[model samples]
Target: MSLLSTVRNPHDLKKLTAEDLPALAAEIRDFLIHAVARTGGHLGPNLGAVELTLAIHRVFDSPHDRILWDTGHQSYVHKILTGRADDFVNLRQRGGLSGYPSQAESPHDIIENSHASTALSYADGLARAYALRGESRSVVAVVGDGALTGGMCWEAMNNIAAADRPVIIIVNDNGRSYAPTIGGLADHLASLRLAPEYEQVLDVVKQVLGRTPLVGPPLYDALHGIKRGIKDVIQPQGMFEDLGLKYVGPVDGHDVHALETALRRARDFGGPVIVHCVTRKGFGYPAAEQDDADCFHAVGVIDPSTGKPTAAGGGTSWTSVFADEIVQIGHERPDVVTLTAAMLQPVGLKKFASTFPDRVFDVGIAEQHAVTSAAGLALGGIKPVVCVYATFLNRAFDQVLMDVALHRLPVTFVLDRAGVTGEDGPSHNGMWDMSFLQLVPGLSLAAPRDATTLRAQLREAVAITDGPSVVRFSKGKINADIPAIDRVGTVDVIYRSPEVTPTREVLLVAVGAMAATCLQVAERVASHGIGITVVDPRWVKPLDPVLVDLARAHSLVVTVEDNGRVGGVGSTLAQLLRDADVDVPLRDFGIPQTFLDQGKRDQVMADIGLSAQELARRIVELAASRAPALTTGEAEEETPAGQR
Candidate 1:
């Protein structure tokens, strides 16, 4: 049996000999590559964090010690140490191991928010609570150097230093969050890594100060006062020490012993201290290390031997559609600029950045900065297209509202992965964008049903110079073009059952990516002798005026979307129907108002009854219930198929 197999938990890990850990680290990496290759998860981050995680587990007793992870995707190694090694087979699947820290999973795990730059604030609050309760346990926050680019990290650091709490802030400097971390902070950290000898020089200076007779302790105190100045002379920046927090070495993060020693010394210091540990993003795996695009940060099922994706690539994705069109737009409009919050490739901005390097701006992990800066770019007569994941865009809501919407800036916000993004779990789902953005007055939101509409709508969003515009799309392949049989003003009539003749029993309103499912539902219902008219409202927000008339002509109006039912496009349309005094019974089918678990996207949709078969059954039931009301009224002549 391997050393890793013998160690089930941190207690077991503590029993391992010094020489046994190297073999254990190797076992852990081997296990991760195979397991994650089968399961498809955040493989690269976990692989890089093996030694650092082991060091943390060996030096500190968890649960009682309150070890927190920022952007918890890198917690796979931590999970393995906490007796979850057996759970790898079902990782990120339903009822299996989560991709991130789960409070319900174990006492060793806490703070399940998978978002970035939040660990420092959480540590500050936990430390304060422990201090008040007279608890002597230590609080450690393992934050990535990438997370430090966020403004909230700085906010927490300011308060942490002022409070003078015993919090250990481990800076996991792998220098990435989806891509090479951008901005001045990344440059500063590089400088720190280059000056590894400074740690030894500082130790000698401290020893010399201690030996001096009368001025020994006083000079040591005075040396502490001038440490920032001394750091500036030797290093490019002294920002950390300037904040009144003790700074430690850029230690070898791959060296478990060195990390443990640095952590132990920081833990012994009864004040806030930062331990900078440098490691590679994909340490052992040559394939992952050589991957320039995000270092394979998040990956799908792959061949372990070659590290290439095993699964066949699907058709042109919504991202690819945007990626191609945006490049064309860049060529047509030289004033157009693009911005990404550290995700240059994931959000489909890599080609755009490469074609127009001068026009692209990667603002690190700071989404809020990305938005406000886009607003500034718009004010400067440059059209800024901010490409970001839908879930991460939630972090910049305040900035989007005030900086862009309030000023009615002409910035275009492209939200990729805009709904029910499964496997990464609840925090990763892009289900809340439509509901939240509805409240923004001047923001016009578009959800395209196919690649054709995606290209058309993207151009429409960019042309609007008077106010902000948003284009949101899902994670997977773009659906085949659902040909518009006819047009009802701005709405595209996708499917109309020929069997029902003149009278339409149901008006199916499909929102964005839900068009294919709605069409399938329409076909299923048509078998039951119910006539359906399915339309895709290319622009969902500010309900197209023609929908009020379309809803009145049908017996039942069924709205379908991939977003949550509450405050979604369906809910908004229902309200509009009521305001227009249309008596048609409205039925909304969408994701329930609750947190969804990790699973295949199709499985989650089926589990939640968002499938075509399920929706067709519901629509038939709803139409049957309204039969009594329809019978009470006089029969009217059915209009011709396209006449309406």
Candidate 2:
């Protein structure tokens, strides 16, 4: 059997000799490539962290000695060493292994936020808790160098230094978060890597002092002052040292023995200490190593040999549609500029950057700065388009509310992955954007139904010069367009059933990607002799006045969306109907207020009863109970065509 096959847990890993570790690292890398290629996960990060993770597991007794992973993308190797190797086949699928660290998976795992720059704060809290209990356990926080760019890392570090507790801070400096890490911290880390080896010089000085005569004790004390001066001249460890935390090497992260040695010293230091280890983001695989952008950070199912996707490409995604339209907008409007939070390529801002390099800014993993800075740009008479994932925007909620909306800046936010994004699990899903953004005053939110609507609505959003405007779309391929049969003000009528003698209209308000599903539900309901009128409200927020009038003409009204049920567009519109005194029985169909599991988007929707079949059944039941005679010819005639 392979050396890795024997490693059922950390205890089994400890059984291997030092000479066996290099082979084990090789075996683990090989296993990860094939496993992740099949499962489609954070492959590059895990590949880079094989030796570092092995060293960590070897040095720290996890569950007893807490080891936290920042962002959790680099935890696959940790999972393997902690007896989760058998669960790789079902990674990121429903009821399978999570792509990020999960506390339920094993005792070894902790801090499963998956958000960046949070492990250090969690480590500080854990360290304090351990100290209060008079426990002897250690706390090790493995944070990526990219996470250091976030303001939270510095906040935690300031407290950690003041506490002076036994906390081992391992800086996994691969120098990338989605893309190459930006700002002064990245530059400082690069300088640290280039600095002379200080540990070797310190060892030479110690030996020289030991070999001296009776003056050795006095000379050693005097040499300590000189050593500091020498360190200032050679290595730049002063930044961390000045913070009241001990600093260690720019050690080679791929060398398991060296990493283990560095970690051992940090573990024994009895105070906050940082061990700097330099690694390549995609260390093992040739295809990943050569990747310039993000180093293949996350990928779908691919061929192991070529590292190419196995499946053929689908229709143009919502991201690409936005990408193409934004470039055209940049060409047309000189005042239009773009901004992203370290995700230029992921959110389809690369073409915009390439065309207008001066106009585009990548503000590195700092969402708060991105939003507030966009507001500043707007104040200077520039229209800044802030493109970011809907989930990550939660980090800058305060900035969006107070800095942008309160100031009434003409900032446009392009939210990609705005609905039930399934594969990355509950934390990564963009399901909460509608509900959260609803609370922000002076903010108008739009959910486009297809590629055409996304392009048109995006233009409309940018045209608003008074307050902030948001245009959001879901993750996968853009749905086929549902052509409008008629237009009533801003609302697009996607489907209108044949006019019967007695019109019993059920207004189906479809939100964004749910338009197609609502159409299917309309067709199914129409078969039961109930006339269905499906309308796609391109702008979900700031309920269109035309919709209230349309609802009054209909017998029953139903709204379908991919966001959470509470406080969403449906709920807001229901309030509008109540205040307008329209006595239409309304039913809201959306994702329930619960943490959804990871799966394919379609499967997750079906599982949550968001499918057309389920929706049609529910609508039928509600109509029967509310007005049984409406489905028959006994209902009142619909309003005149000219009046509507």
Candidate 3:
């Protein structure tokens, strides 16, 4: 049996011989390749962390000792060793293991911090908690050196060092986060790698001094100061040391034995210690190593040998739609430029980058910087199209309001995955974009119901110099090829029959990807002899007075969306109806106010009552409750014009 097969937990890991650990690391690498091929996941990061994770577990007792993973993308190796090897078969599947560390998935994972640069603060808090409770447990945080580019990591490091608490920080340095890391931190890491002899000399001196006990303690203290001074002259830039934390390594992260020894050494140190491990991302897998594009960071089910996606054909994704549109706009408009928070390929801006290389800006993993930069770009006579994940855009709320909206900058925010993003779990869900964007003054938000509307809205948003504009679209394929629009506009009724009575019992206003499903529900309701009108409110924000007017004409209006029912388009319309004194019974069909679990997109959406069948049933129930109005009944005739 392989070393990995025998090892079920950290206790099992600790029992392994030094020689056996490397074999175990190899086995784990082989296992990851096989497992991820069968069920796709983050391949590159897992391969990178095999030895580091093993070494960490061996040195520190987990469950009792808290270990927080920054970004959680690199925790796949941690998952495999911690009795989750079997779950790899169903990785990132419905009711299966998560792609990232999840608190609910395992006890060993302390913080499921999917966001970058967040684990340090969690580690600091845990360290303080342990100290407050007089506990003996150690607090360890595994943060990527790439995450150091984020401003929050610096803030955490500064605070953690100020508290001077006993905590260990493992910096997994491979010089990349999504794309290669940018800004000051990347330069520092590059400098460290350039001076390879520094680590070798330090190691030799440490070993020699460690042998003599009488002078060892004093010699090590003096050597540390000398090393710091030497680093100042040679390296001159230790970010962690500058922040007041004890610095260790530039060590070989692939050797489990050496890494364990370093961790044990750091454990003995009294204050916050940063162990900088230099490892290769996509280390063992040749496919991952060869892949310059994020090291196949998050793979779909793929052929292990070929490293190509196994899933078959689909039309262009919503991201591609935006990227193509942006490129077209960039070609047409000289002032147009693009910005992304280290997500160019995923957001489909690669072509744009090639075409307008100078116009495109990859702002690392700094969402805050991307937004503020867009604002600045707008100020400098440029129109910036900021393409970012809907979930990540939450990081730039202040910049969006204070910097952009207050000044009425003509920056277009393109939110990709603006609804339930399956498999990524609650942290990655784009359900809150509508709710959050509602609070921003002078910031107009649009939700495109189809590819055609998305194209129109993009053009419209770019032309708007009156204020900041946000255009959000869902993930996955655009099922239908909508007719190209000549001009920019908002709110279009796609399916309506003039032969039928003007009275619409159920006026369906669907947003983004939910439009097709809403149409299906309308068709089902119509077949059952209930007249319904389906409309796509292209602009979910601005409350589209026209949509409210349509709602006033209906006896029962049901608003369908993939976002949360609370503070969503449905909620906004309800408030608008209430404010206008239009007392129509409106039903909102949306994802509930709860964290969703992982699954296939359709399966997950169906589970959340977003399926056409489920929506049709709800509509039928509503129609059953509503008794038909008598012809002789005198009506108040609540006019929609006055309500608007």
For 1-644, candidate 1 gives per-residue lDDT tens digits of: 77888988899999998889999999999999999999899988888899999999999998789999987998999999999999999999988899999998999998895889999999999999999999998999999838888888999999999877899999999988888999899999988888855777677777877787778677768877566555776775578877888888788999989899999999999999999999899889999999998787988999988899998998789999999999999999999999998889999998998899999999988999999999999999999999999999899999999999999999999999988888989998898899899989888999999999999999999999988999999998889888899998999999988777335489999999999888899999998888889999999877898999998888888888888777888878878887898877776767777888889898888887788888888677767666543421122233111011
Per-residue lDDT of candidate 3, residues 171-264 (tens digit): 8998888767777678888887678777766767778777867876677799777877777766655667878888887778898778987898
Worst 10 residues of 2 by lDDT: 635-644
Ranking by lDDT: 1, 2, 3
lDDT of each: 0.88, 0.87, 0.81
- How well is each residue in 4-55 modelled by candidate 2, as lDDT tens digits? 8899999888788999999999999899999999979998888888889999
Largest lDDT belongs to which candidate?
1
Q: Which residue pairs show backbone clashes in model 3? A: 231-236
Q: Ranking under TM-score, best-scoring first?
A: 1, 2, 3
| True-structure lDDT of candidate 1 | 0.88
